[model samples]
Target: MLQQETRDMDGHYEFVTVSDEATIAFRRYGTPGKPRLLLIHSLALDGSIWTDVISGLQGQAEILCIDCRGHGWSSRAPLSYAIERYADDAAEVLDKVGWDQVVVAGCSMGGCIAQAFAVRYPKRVSAMILIDTTAWYGEKAPQEWRARAQKARAEGLASMAAFQATRWFGDRFRAENPRKIQEMMEIFVRNDLDAYEATCIMLGDADLRSALSGFHFPVSVIVGEEDYATPIESARQLAKAIPGASLTILPGARHLTPIECSDVIAEAIAKMIEAAAH
Candidate 1:
């Protein structure tokens, strides 16, 4: 039997075995009968990153926040942590919860997995919101990611926290929200080294550019004006590729738009859910 624990009054933490060696941890929020929303977080970050977004969405929808394989309390099995694999794990979560369709929202690495999920399981995704992510990382990204992975394995995640923070938040936001920045940095530092390394490789290899044209669902691409990791240009390209996709760029935000601009993202997701329902 999978180990299950209820966290707080509004959220339930549960683990579902997705593979022989892997068990994925996820949190359930809001009422079950309401519209379902699956929230996926960025690389190295867990589902807790969506706390504010979940709060903003209270009483509006049933939210399932997944800690993707190799992150958070999810098991770090000896499996390839590819983006497609992450998508499959997410589908397993839906299957476990008996949800037929959901509004899938993901940020950064999670966005890549969301793209894979939409492409592979078109019938299961009602809508998709890609946040602070791109369809591809260019030709040189794989090499750079591999190197980073090697370094993380050697030096540990704590060494990368400060550097990653720079890409995750803009200078002004970091200065204004020092506590929040430190909280996120702590999350990064707590990551398992092997899982972090594997995820870096996953991000490096994932390229969904050619696959975007096939996504027929209502799509919304949101980016931060100051996102250095996945820039606004990448978001524009993704919006152009997906049919009828709308693009929104939040000013003064960085790679962590979902955290830095939770209200805006929550509102956008609410609109997407509303449009998908009709």
Candidate 2:
């Protein structure tokens, strides 16, 4: 449903069709056998959301940045959107790419997808890093998420660009990188309204807290000190849910740390790569 790639990055785009008939889009980067990574982007955004961070992790990590169904070049599935379906799509993509296992990392909606992947395809994931996301949005999440979806349906995704900008980055990052902000805004407006609403309702009902204790792989939780979207409490809860998981909170950063705290994120991935090798 999205147009051809518009980001400034040079990732080689590829496409694959899952069992459900939705065509998914992904980009390959780095070399093989050097810490395989799978990066998932936030809601209303595509895999290119990791453009800046992917550049930082290049050469050292073989990575796949996937545009989840209905988000980017991926098809807007005729069925309703669900986190588990997205996870299954990731696994199918892995089969096509020949990746046996990968360090799954996701931000916001992607982070929720990462959690679902860990639960549904335990053998397919080597490690996981959850960023700026939560296992659940809380007691009133269903109502709140539905309301947000209706607002978008009525007013269009463009109406929330300013809000998304504020939640995604801090004043400093916004002032320093206006073009990236503009691109993000564009992506938000380009989303399919129906798919966007379904995805929101899916997220509203998504609950992975019960499965966190079952996670066998190494889990790392990262959050920005100023991230009110998921917030510090959410990251703390996630960290506590998984045994042996480490939590890192970046100072002065907001929800999208992949852009503002890319160096720190790269360091975290390096550490995970080392841990997996041992």
Candidate 3:
């Protein structure tokens, strides 16, 4: 719970009003002059999802962990919620923070936003990592996503926690990380219903397959081998669509690679940084 403008460890938390008049919350870590990395979280989750991942990244890179407009400390009731809008928000945050270009990393819903960001503001992204996300949710996406949103609308976000847990982590991880699972559930249950519904619908209607092929920046697709929400097949499709994109599959991990495979992710970003320097 970082308050806006509360400086600590040479980093601070801040907020920026986006196109829709919604305040998006973000926290900066590490020295200002260091290389930057933008971390976006998944559906029903916030930037805190990157807590473990950030520790490995902090010393080497200046990291901006964002709580997307609809989740975490950001404004829950927004004028609209869409992947493109989220992407635009990222650009605004970058401008405010003076990060000209960065390595963008996102998981699940955040990955969609990252893809949208690269498309709309390509020059701002030097490299990107898409984890546990898809370009499109198949032909039945609209109906399927609508159903999920409707369930949350009717039963509430907490009701989906069990289902989300299974999709987010393999049985092994769930057994191994009881505390982490509980922490994530706490975040999921705090979400505003209206905003969560809108986000689900936005994901339902999102289609970025055509836009992905045009991406010229370095891209990497990482996914848990057991991820069901956005499975390995989806990751494979993303790798195939983006020119020269690399794909990494982690065994026994699920959708939340930021938590379950943070070290691997940090290594991948380090590689991205090394590659981008050349």
Candidate 4:
């Protein structure tokens, strides 16, 4: 069973200077003795999105949730964004904490980074958990998404927030969770347009499908039941492609299921970890 937090929980937050100039902000939750689980956020969102999931897993695992470079509290870098770069940043965070092995989990863009990490540094990852993402870039993404990236590069983040909102959430979620929708929009708006545009280009260019099949570690794939962005069909294909991988569907969930349905997501991940222990 998933552990429930009956009382308010607080965690310690700090910054690690990864590349001399760039400082990555991370929040540490749970005790020092527990196994560490790294949580990566989706594009336009920060580590805070994992709050709900963390609440359930805190009793079982220590979580190190990072705000990727160019998003949230992390310092922007002059370098162009890539999944590899994000993986390197994650490695840096783990190095700082002295965790040689960990369960790496990511959502959407974060999931892409996790795959990159597992492929590049297999020795560092004990297991991998991916949510609502693909190992390869979309075969034919909406042309308007590319257009929006270009617009953001030229105009600014404010002009791109609406498109982000539409792409990140399903219609029903946007209708029912107006407050959450508005909050996410604000985060996207807060992002530096150049960085966001660069990240979008990186996402479009990433293709790790070939490398995914080679990973020997335990892998679990998850998706929202109603995820239209990546879709459950695509996630199922990913599950089939990777060896010994299992897939779970979060019911009544949208693309933002990690945030909207954190309790279930956290429990699913916790259960996966427990099962892996044997």
Backbone atom clashes (below 3 Å) for every candidate = 0, 0, 0, 0
Whole-model lDDT, model 3:
0.87
- Compared with the true structure, all predictions reach lDDT values of 0.89, 0.89, 0.87, 0.81
Q: Estimated TM-score per prediction?
A: 0.94, 0.95, 0.94, 0.89
Error of 4 at 84 (Å): 1.3
Alpha-carbon deviation at 148 in model 4, angstroms:
3.0
| Tens digits of lDDT, candidate 1, 1-278 | 95443225357789999865589999898765778999999998899888888888887888899999988889974667878889999999999989989999999998999999998899998999999998899899999999998888888878888899898988988889899989988988888877878888888988888988999889999999988899989999999999999999998899988888889999999999998898
lDDT string, candidate 4, 1-278, tens digits: 96644323466668988764588898888766666789999987799888879887867887889999888999874764767878989999999988888888899989989999888898887788899998776665434457768887788888767776776777777888899888888887888766777787777778888887887878899998878777899899889989999999887676777887778888877876675565
Residue range 86-169, candidate 3, lDDT tens digits: 998999999987778999998999999999999999888889999889899888998999999899888888888998888888
Off by over 4 Å in 3: 1-12
Candidate 2 lowest-lDDT run of ten:
2-11
Error of 4 at 159 (Å): 3.8
Per-residue lDDT value at 170 in model 4: 71
Clash pairs detected, candidate 4: none
Task: Look at candidate 4 and tell me the lDDT of residue 190.
Answer: 84
**Better TM-score candidate (1, 4):** 1
